[model samples]
Target: MNCGCDEQRRVTVSRRRLLAAGAAGAFAGLAGSQLDTQLAFAADPAYSGDVLVLLSLRGGFDGLSAVVPAGDPAYYAARPTIAVPKAQLIGGGTFFGLHPALAPLLPYWTSGKLAAVHAVGQPAPNRSHFAAMEELERAAPGTSLRTGWLNRMAGSLGADDPFDAVAMGTARPARVLDGPAPYLGLTSIDAFTLTGDDAVKPVAATMAALYQGAPPALARTAGQLTGALARAKALRSAGYTPANGAAYPSTELGAALRDVARLIKTGAGLMTATVDSGDWDMHENLGPAQPGRRMHDQLAQLAAALAAFATDLGPDGLNRVTLVTISEFGRRVAQNGSGGLDHGYGNAMFVLGGGVRGGRVYGSWPGLTAAQLRDGDLAVTTDYRAVIGEILRARCRVGDLAPVFPGVTASSLGLVATR
Candidate 1:
């Protein structure tokens, strides 16, 4: 996976550590804040590309339950107890069908704004959550590069502001946004501020004066922090109301996505944003396709949040945004004795945006027959990186993807239209 790039030549800094140092003394209250998400800004304000939203479905997600292969008899045989009955599926084609739980997104799927890619995974099989996720985010399997692919993409886009790349939602660390690219992490928009910064104390003002005469590196870091705080303040002042009557659910995912919509609509120079949703590791009692069941409830929540996001953006706003879903890995082809699944190989990805060629599943489906299974799991026919690389090239205008995903070429699935 060596791309002839020198990792030593690229100077990097942890934005989190930089913030802690910049406000070391004055902002003692900073420790109490829940700063989990990160945001970085681009230097080129005129840069025109889709706002790439990456939704990481953490834990081992069961793609088989979500996107059922009803046409394949082998699929039913493998998971007879847990398989989604063909009669309950929606958005059906000759081969694939959407889980009924994903009904919220069926309109988007039918309207050519949503699509799914099956049989997608890494170059090699990795069932360990930590190792697989680390590799998934790093995205350069055989290379010495430690930077996340999103960070590389930001660097390629000439991102200089601390708000260009954002990791929005829950306090979970977004390993995908790690690298040299200047980014800011916070729980939400309103929460992004220097603690105790009021009219009386004025912590931000004090820090600005303190670093005014500091060295270039120190001063630049301070400036980025202060500048980001100012922008966040402005956004807070301008109260938001979701457009198109889109009602976001009362959940963490819903709140995170609502904020993402706010940032995009505010015309913030948001090039890429990452959000995470966990608890997909259903090892037992996965239940049935009913509302109270585990799989159904999770998918319903996911579809609701995503549907609200798209609705709030509307057609015009959505035209400039592209959202994709990925997980560390997928569940096994066969359900276990407990009626749940274990970590497996191949997975499925959902691509949603105005530019997406929707209404059908796209991928080279290696049949689910026992002979085709990779060690009792669905064999990966298309690399996940290639799926993303195609989107990067077509929608984001990234000419060369080798730096971001070494030794991988974009899939020619025509999944997205050229920007």
Candidate 2:
């Protein structure tokens, strides 16, 4: 028919117009380009006075070796080979001495800014490292726990945004940081990002929209991280440098700690940052006397890092940070054939900072006799939860410790400064 001419005119369309429409949709994310950034995790807020720096001493630590009970005859009697001499201690105190390895902490102790809690740990008698560590990590002693205590604590704190809680290790480790919330988990705050600049914005928006209704906690956390991509990107582009001629030791923990210092100063939310140090489980070659066997080198390295963190942060930075160190458990009262201490119960926990009452060992000491041992371990007089719980309530402004450490109660050790 003659309508072919009319049909051709009606169906005619320009390539440029079609391309423009497609490009517009992509830019608007209708074609899924507006949002494409993964919003599953990271970045919550800047530190706001209430923050904790958790330093975990992995492996079983020898509390007795760390803080010698020189005044107790049972202590010297129990370990004639590994006992520290009271005379070498920096401060003249009753019934106590510091291991030759812990010389760095002497100043903190003398200044009364360090509170040492001996015979502290969960009552879970299970010595399996995997089980015990998990138990402590969950902050739950008797029951099976899912989320980490730190996660729960953050939940209880009830911040407007959940990204305040942070763990300094890998994306996810054990106990303390598990749960649903916005928690930043970058070993390097330096390498986090949202691909592309202007082009990436549309994709980032699309990605965020895709996760519009997910409940994996990680999903919501992802949403919270969208705004942080820019900040994270900038932190990554800018490198970090230490101060006061403070050089970190060439150890994994030392590096991690240095990173933590950098993040804290950069004004990250960082309510809680955990830095773990492994290799404390000395079953065979723990030489408490020798240079490398037991405590000498390890203590020096630990002290150097702590001192450096404190100095760089200075009084103000030091005041804002609360550093607590713990191990899975303590070592045995008696030395083994391999010249090392075996797994036992009741290790010491160290609280160091400007706010700590310090300079004195808190907690009632349990004797090293067979009858006093809890299944051949030192009897636990102070629960680890009580110490940490009190700090959370007092310093962090999170009054309810029950949820963070479910079914457990806390008593204040008066470790914080009276100000």
Candidate 3:
């Protein structure tokens, strides 16, 4: 009875401490404490490297269908009803083949601007979507670190600029960017404005006046909002159109990436940005590599958006941008009765950039034999963090990865050129 009481007290105290820390951080954000201090101090230098774009595939991504291992007999045997046929594949080598739906990316793949790593996943298998995504974003396994890896990376770089890191396509911030780094969440560029700001009565201006000569917290918060409104207004006035004859699909992913390109072109000091694409869950009716099938249409949409993004960026713009695709986890190797895969392990990651060594797949080909499977799931041969770490070190020019990945040695896949 005494021990139980003590445990309850400890839990209450921990919750209180957590609440206090959160409140303080919220207030500090209002005051721009970290960003304000950053601008005042010359402690950290500027990051001169690629603008990293993290694309989150929200549902379980089936790598076996996408980066098909045509050479693996077991893969075909396991997914007898759903394997991507060998003849329908595109740019992969003798051992691997790209799904026919990904043909839109053929040019970039052939030109050595896109690459992929297979048999890659988290440190451990997690079948639950919420738990897997949470762990994926938090990144620090076997540790007490609560900050997201992307936020940690931004903080490490001493990013004070509001545009340094952004979560596009949603007003809510991505869990990956949930630290002290000064970042913004926007549904779109033009949509980022004060609730009541207009030509006649500027709400931003009114708020500024109301907070005039107020305490640092209140005053700074008003100033930041006003400043953001001004920037948005300027961007809206400028008017943006896709460059290099790039045609963006009229889709959410397309628009989000279009905005990202706009920010990059406008020189907004964008270090990192995250966008999400869903509906890859495909637990039923994930048809063949045809135009009318569920998986086919989904992949087509993704391909079109990505191809448009690359086209808009053009060669010069893409030279400084690295886009990576990650999911919480991959689906099962074998198809179920409904002709779909369930949550499993050992997914695939795609890397696209000028520095990427394209036209081939990276990582050891973990065999799909029943004996080799991890409880009916593909065994992970490469840690996903290591893959990101490699990109961070090589393309992003991050000198020390210890702070971001914590004790993980980055893979030497030569997937991207060294800085």
- TM-score of every candidate relative to the true structure: 0.91, 0.79, 0.88
lDDT assessment of candidate 1: 0.81
lDDT of 3 by residue, 312-418 (tens): 99999899899999999998988989998888999899999888988889999778889988889888999999999999999887889999999899999989997
Candidate closest to the true structure, highest lDDT: 1
The lDDT of each candidate is 0.81, 0.64, 0.76
Q: What does candidate 2's lDDT look like per residue over 252-307, in tens digits?
A: 55666777777677765666677677677878766654467556677777877787
Arranged by TM-score, best first: 1, 3, 2
What is the alpha-carbon lDDT of model 2 when measured against the actual structure?
0.64
Candidate 1 per-residue C-alpha lDDT over 1-419 given as tens digits, one digit per residue, 9 for 90 to 100? 21323331111223344466553311111111211234556767676899899988889888989999999999999887888999999996889999999999999999999999999998999999999999999999878999889988988998887453332222224678777776655546766655467799887788789889898877776676677778888988997899999999986678778988998887767888777788898898898899999999999999999999999999998999999999999999998999999999999999999999999999999998889999999999999999999999999989999999999999999999998
Using lDDT as the yardstick, the better of models 1 and 2 is 1
How many clashes does the backbone of model 1 have?
12
Q: What 10-residue stretch in candidate 2 is worst by lDDT?
A: 26-35
The alpha-carbon root-mean-square deviation between model 3 and the true structure, to one decimal in Å, is: 9.0
Count of residue pairs whose backbone atoms collide, per candidate:
12, 25, 0
C-alpha positional error of residue 76 in candidate 1 after TM-score superposition, expressed in Å: 1.4
What does each candidate score in C-alpha RMSD?
A: 7.0, 13.4, 9.0
